[model samples]
Target: MDYALKESSTKFETILGTALKVPGVRVDREQFLLQTLGSKIKDGNIVNLAIETDPVTAGIPIDKLDKIANSLIKKRTTNTSMLSFAAGMPGGVTMAATIPADTLQFFGTAIKLAQELVYLYGYGEIGNANQLDEDIRRELTLYLGVMLGVEKSAAALRVLSTNISKQVVKRTSRRALSKTTLYPIVKKIGAIVGVKVTKASFAKNVSKAVPIVGGIVSGGTSYLSMKHMGHRLSETLSESIYYTDADYEKDFKEVCNEVVDVEFN
Candidate 1:
């Protein structure tokens, strides 16, 4: 790997590790969703599930996923915000360390939302951290970059989608992805997303330091920011080529070389 790509990968791992360590970050809802989706993938029941749940989601429309993402974020933000405020209030001093904790909550929520939306859009199960294949992992990273509004990642995703549509296999795709030509873009994406997360965390810390109404302000800020990130992910991922059943099945069979029986009901 290039130096920049290696550095960005390290930063990504560190940030993800920190986020996973936060209490209440891995909520039951997220676990349930993942497990359910994983089971669906294993059983090859995704298409039926999509049709039974929402016919429109067969294409994974951005607006529909956006609504779901908004609901998910709204449901969790209040509790996370309060917890963040309490964590920061140490001897009447808002410790900077608490910022990471608060940000981790948001990161966890954002990641969960991203995964759920991507799965619903027909990207298949993003398995557990240890179980994720390199292709799927890279796809998730690309989605994260999209969630962070990285234009280069977005453009790359489009190209990737085109390639998948052409039935690119895993080896060929991996080779292209591993090329130095793409390393710079991937590195840039990681840097941009990392900076955005850091900046957001800092702003939350500043808002939480207010005297009387700090908690309220922090809560509001967290709510809006989390919702914004969730919507961003939903918008980008839902509209992706991978959202359609046909496209997803094609990619899954060709790229992953797995026979996924898609049941349309």
Candidate 2:
């Protein structure tokens, strides 16, 4: 397809919003943990496990989750690459202001992979409500930001994760995800995404990879890209601390201030 992602915060934000609304796109923490844990975890106990503790501390094996996560990444990468390949078929046309099918699919899979990784690492769902509330959206943005290599996003997530673990709740209501606190961070992340993905790099590469005649080049590129991103988030969540309330309070203030101070056009 001729459509190339533009260098604009609006576009990136729109993509983020759209990717999130897709049916069944967001992974349910309890459901995922149960399925992932399989029979090893007693049915009734598994559901509470997500709210009370993370997967590892609950005795869910890290190796098992890692292996499953790899399979998921590979599967999603392959699926997206195939779509990219199809879109580049000899007669495929690129339309202006249009988002590529491959790009959309990539975000969907990325979000899916992200949620799974968090669940496997022992964090609860970002948001499981019927609506995409501001709180939920903020968390999702942070996840995408982390995937894109934004340090501030990771910091905020660490705070959110620690808070969520402490509460025994389905989600974190911490100000870390509040609009006031996250707006600047969100904008900064958008700018970063715009710079990182804007037709300049991601598009140019994909457009070139899938030549007039479709090929596996683009697919290979996607596989590596998705794997890299998945690893970043997985590593981040794994290392997040759930230790002390005082540490969280200190970290929370610093992260919120730093994120707020960051500016993005």
Using lDDT as the measure, which candidate wins? 2
Could you give candidate 1's per-residue lDDT for residues 105-221 as a string of tens digits?
656666666656654444444444445344444555666787777655655654453222211223433323233344445545666676676666677567756644666666667
Number of the top-ranking candidate, with TM-score as the measure: 2
Worst 10 residues of 1 by lDDT: 256-265
Q: Model 2: per-residue lDDT, tens digit, 3-43?
A: 23224666777677777877767787767766666644565
What is the total number of backbone clashes in candidate 1? 0
> Scored by Cα lDDT, where does model 2 land?
0.63
- Model 2 pairs whose backbones collide: 2-93, 2-94, 54-122, 55-122
lDDT (Cα, 0-100) at 17 in candidate 1:
58
| lDDT at 178, model 1 | 33
lDDT of 1 at 163: 20
Residue pairs clashing, model 1: none
Off by over 4 Å in 2: 1-7, 39-54, 90-97, 130-132, 160-163, 166-179, 200-214, 241-257, 263-265
